[model samples]
Target: MVYRGPYRVRVEEKDRPVIEHPNDAIVRVTRAAICGSDLHLYHGMMPDTRVGMTFGHEFVGVVDEVGPSVRNVKRGDRVMVPFNVYCGSCFFCARGLFSNCHNVNPNATAVGGIYGYSHTCGGYDGGQSEYVRVPFADVGPSLIPEWMDDDDAVLLTDALATGYFGAQLGDIVEGDVVVVFGAGPVGLYAAKSAWLMGAGRVIVIDHLDYRLEKAASFAHAETYNFAEYDDIVVHMKKITDHLGADVAIDAVGAEADGNLLQHVTATKLKLQGGSPIALNWAIDSVRKGGTISVMGAYGPMFSAVKFGDAMNKGLTLRMNQCPVKRQWPRLFEHVRNGYLKPSDIVTHRIPLEHVAEAYHIFSAKLDGCIKPLIVPSAA
Candidate 1:
C-alpha cells in the first residue's frame, strides 16, 4: 500500500524495499495494523508526507533478508517492527532512550526517525507493503518467539511496548488503584499493563459501551461508561475509598471533539492554543502524591501545562515519546510468558485492499473498532 495523496490508497506495484545499509534487514510483513498515528498522516495531519511514501507503523513480519552486520535477527525468524528506528550506538540509545537518537534522521527536521515517515529517515518505505526495509535491524527489530501467533506478535513492537512504558512511568505497584482514560487500544493496553504490574484495581474509562465491555473482557480491567457516569471521579472514588487513583494514565491526547474550546477565553486562549483539556484532566484526577503517565500520541509541541495543579497534589508527571528500542525486549518476554495479551485489543481484521474502508471505520470509531489488524493482499 502506498499513499498517492490524502484520503487515497491503492495496491500498486513497486520494487520491494531492500537492505541497503550494513545494519539493515528486509522483512516480509505478516500482519500490519492501521495505527492512530497513521490517521494523522492519512488525514493530512502530517506535513511533508508526499505521494509514494508508505504509511504504517505497527506490523509483525518474518525476516526474509538481513544485512551482513545484523546479528540479533536472521532470515526465517519472526519479528515485530518498532515505530522509531534507532541507531544502536547513538548517545541517546546508550541511555536506553531511543526516541531521542541522534543519527537515525540526519536530514529530517527532527531527529526521532520513523519508517514510512519522511526523507529524514533515509526515505525508507513502511511495512504496509508486502515487504519493508529496516535500518539498524539489531536494535530496531525484536524477534518473536516461535510459539507466538501473528496476533501476539502484532503488539510486541508498538502498542504493547507503549502500555508497558506507560505502566512503568505511572509507577504502578501492588495494591495501588489505577485508572486509565480513553479505553482505546492504547488505553486498553495501559490498563492491562497496570494489571500485570500488580495494581490492586484497574478501571478503564471510555464513552463507547462496546469498547468498554471489550476492555473488561480482554484486559481484565474494570470498565466505566463515561457517558453514563455522572461524575467519573466520584464513581472511581467509590471503588477506591474516595482517595482517587494512585495512578491515572491519560490515553486521550487532546480534548474529545470541541468541548474544551467552548468559551475560548482570551486569557486562557493565548496559552490554551494547543491540546488543552486532556492534559488538564490527567493532571487533575490523581490523588496526592500520585503519578500520571501519558502514552497518547501527540504532535511536536503544546502550550504551557498547569504546573500549579500538579504541584499542589505532589503528583509526578511523565510524558515523552516511547523509547521503543529499550522497551521492546521486556515487553516481548511478557508476551512470551503469557503475562500480557495485547492482541485481544484487536476488534477487526480486514484485507489490505480495503485499507481505505478500514480507515473510515477506524477513524469514525464506527462498529466497535478497537484495533483493526490489516492483512496485506499477498498475505
Candidate 2:
C-alpha cells in the first residue's frame, strides 16, 4: 500500500527490503492488518504523512533473511513483529516502556519509531508491502507459536495486545464498572480484557449497530448506540446511578464524531490536533477520581479538551502507545486458554492487489468491515 496523499492510495511495485543493520531482519509479509490508526493517515489526519509511504503496523511474516548479529531468529522462521520499533537497550525499553524507546526515533521525543506510519515515526516502510525491513529483530519479532492460528497471531501483533494494554492502563479492579467509547476492534478487545481483569460490567458505546451487536455477542457487554441518545453522557451518568463509571476508555480518536464544533475544528478545519469528542465524553461520563485510559491515537498538535474538569474531578489519566512486545506473554496465555480469539473480529481478508479497495471499504465503513487483513503474497 502506497499513500499518494489523503484518500489516495494504490498498490505499486516496490523494491524488496534488505537487512540495513546488524540487528535488522527482512520479513516477507504473509498477513498484515489495516488498523483503525491507519485511517488517520489515510484521511490525512496525522502530520508528516508523506506520499508513497506504506501504512500497516500489524503484521506477521516469515523471516526471509537476517543480518549477522541476529541470533534469535533465522531465515524461514515464522514471526510476529510488534508495531513498535525499539532497540531494547534504551532507557525506556530497559524499564519496559518499549513504546517510548529513545534510540529508535531520535528525532521525535514524543513517540518511538513505528513501521509504515510516516517520517514522524522513523520513516520505516510499513509491512503492508510484500517485504518489510524490521529493525531490532531480536527485541521486536517473536516466533509465531505453531499451535496458534495465523489470523490470531497477526491480530496479536497489535490490535489484541493494544486492547489488553488499554485495559491494563485503566487499572481495572474487581467489580469495577468500565465504559469503553467505541465498538471497533480495540474497543471490543478492551471490553473483553476488562472482564479478565474482573470488571463487573462493561458498556460499549458506538453509533453503528453492527459493531454494537458484536460488542454484545463477542465481548458479552452491554451496548448502546450514541446516535439513539440525545445526551449520551447524561444517559451514562443516569445509568451509573449519577456517580458515573469507574473507568472510561477512549478507544475512538482523531476522527470521532459527536460534537459538530469538535468535528469541524479538529478534522475539517485542521485547527486542533484531532477530534476530542470521545475524550471529552470520557471525562464527563467517568466518576470523580475515576481513571481514563486513552488507547486512541491523537495528532502531535493541540486539542481542545476539558482539562479543567479533569483536574477538578481528579481523574487519573493514563495513556501511551502500546508497548506491544511487553504485553505479549499475557496475550499468549489468553489466546492459548481460549479466553480470547483475536481473529474473531476479522471481517475481511483482502489481497494486496485490492488494498486500495480495502482502504476504501474500511474508510467508508461499507460492507460491515470490522477488521480487514491484507494477504500480501496469497500464501
Candidate 3:
C-alpha cells in the first residue's frame, strides 16, 4: 500500500525494496504494525511526512537477501527492524547514543532516521510494503529467536523499546514506587518495564477503563481512572503515604490541560491536554528528588517550561525521542531469555485494506483498542 495522500492507503503495484547499500539487507515483511506515531503522519502532523511515502515503521520480517558486507544475518533469518536506521560508527552511535547518529541524521536528529519518513530520513521506503530496504542492516536489525512468535518480535521495533527507554530514564529500581501517567501501549509498556526493572509499586492513571484493565493484568500496575478520582494527588498520597511515587513517567505528552495545577479536568483521549499537563502532574505527584521521564512525541520548539517548579522539587527530568539502536541490543537479551513478554500489550489485529477504518477506530478509541497491529494485504 502507498500513502498516496494524507488519510489514505491505496494498494499499488511496484517493485519491492532492495538492498541498495553495502551494509543493507532486504527483508520480506511477515508482520507490520500501525503505530501511534504512524497516526501523526497519517493525520499530516509530521512536518516531514510526504505523499507516496510507504507508511509503517514497526515490523518483524524474514531476511530475503543481504549485501556483501552484511555479517550477522543470513537468508531466512527472522528479524525485527529498528524504527531508526543508524551507522554504528557515527559520533552518536559510538557513544551508545543511537538516536542522535550524525551519519543518518546529520542535519536534524543526532542519532537516527526513520524508514518510510520523507526528507527527514533518506527517503527510504518502509516495511509497509512486501519488502523493505534496511540501511546499516547488520547494526540495525535484530534476529528473532525461533521460539519467539512474530507478534512478540514486533514490539522490539518500537513500543517496547520506547517503554524500556522511559523506564530507564525514570530511574525505576528495586523497591521504588513508580507511576505511569498513561494507559496507551507505550504507557502500559512503561509500567511493565518498571516492574521488570524491580519497582516495588507500579501505578497507572488513565480514563480508559479497558486500557487501564489491560495495564492491571499485563503490567501488574495499579489502575486509577482519572475520571473517578476528584484529586489524583490525594489518591496517590493515600497509596504512597503522602510522599507520592518515587518516579512519574509522562507518557501522555503535550495533550492535556494541567501543567501548573494539581487538579486535572477530565477530557477525551488525544484531546484537551498535551505533554505539559502530564509533566505538571508528574512534578506534583512525585516525591521530592524523584525522577521524571517524558517519552511522548512533541514538537521541536517549545514556548516555556516551568523550570521553577521542576527545580524547586529537585526532580531529575529525562526527556528524549527514542534512540532505538541504543536499546535494541540490550533488549534482545531480555527477549531471548523470556524476561519480557512485550507482545502481551497488543489488543487488536487489523488488516492493511482496513487501515483507514482501523486508524479511525484506534485514533478515536471507538472500540476497546489498545495496540492494533496491522497486517498487510499480501501477507
List the candidate 1 regions with Cα displacement exceeding 4 Å. 107-111, 118-124, 229-242, 255-274, 301-304
* Per-residue accuracy of model 2 over 1-379 as CA lDDT, tens digit each: 8999778999998888777899899998999999998987787666677788988999999999999999999999999999999989978999999989999885699799998887888888998889999999888999999898678999988899999999999999999999999999999999999999999999999999999999999999999999999999999999999999999999997663224654455446655557678999999999999999998888754667998999999999999999998888889998899999999999999999899999999988899999999996554
TM-score against native, each model: 0.87, 0.96, 0.88
The local distance difference test score of each candidate is: 0.76, 0.89, 0.77
Q: What would the per-residue lDDT of candidate 1 be over residues 235-310, giving only the tens digit for each residue?
A: 7767777777899898877442323442142123322223645566667667889999987755543556788989
Scanning candidate 2 in windows of ten residues, the lowest lDDT window is 256-265
- Ten contiguous residues with the weakest lDDT in model 1: 265-274
lDDT of 3 by residue, 241-300 (tens): 988899999888754223432112111122222346567788889988999999876543
Pick the TM-score winner. 2
Task: For model 1, state the Cα shift of residue 134 in Å.
Answer: 0.4
C-alpha lDDT of candidate 3 relative to the true structure: 0.77
Assess the local accuracy of residue 81 in candidate 2 as a C-alpha lDDT between 0 and 100: 95
Predictions ranked by TM-score, top down?
2, 3, 1
